[model samples]
Target: MRRIRRSIGEYINLYNGKRPHSSLADQTPDEAHFGTVRAINSGA
Candidate 1:
């Protein structure tokens, strides 16, 4: 159970922090939430 929980947590972190989603215009959840997506594309 503990191992499963750890795996879930890691996946959650990756999902929210690292993985990009097409629904969010290929931005990670954190980037979409913080409005950093434009900055990334505009090269600012």
Candidate 2:
């Protein structure tokens, strides 16, 4: 159970942090995601 949980966490992180998105013009998830982060920061 512990091993399975760790594997799931790793997969989630990999997908959300490393995968690239065509919608973001070939940017990785991290960079594509940061646009939203920057927008929120600017709004605040």
Q: What lDDT does the true structure give each of the candidates? A: 0.92, 0.84
| Tens-digit per-residue lDDT, 1-44, candidate 1 | 99999999999999999999999999999989877767877888
TM-score of each: 0.66, 0.62
Runs in model 1 lying further than 4 Å from the true structure: 36-44
Q: Pick the candidate with the highest lDDT.
A: 1
**Residues 1-44, model 2: lDDT tens digits:** 99999999999888777877788787777887788799899995
How does residue 1 of candidate 1 score in lDDT? 100
TM-score of 1: 0.66
Q: What TM value does model 2 have?
A: 0.62
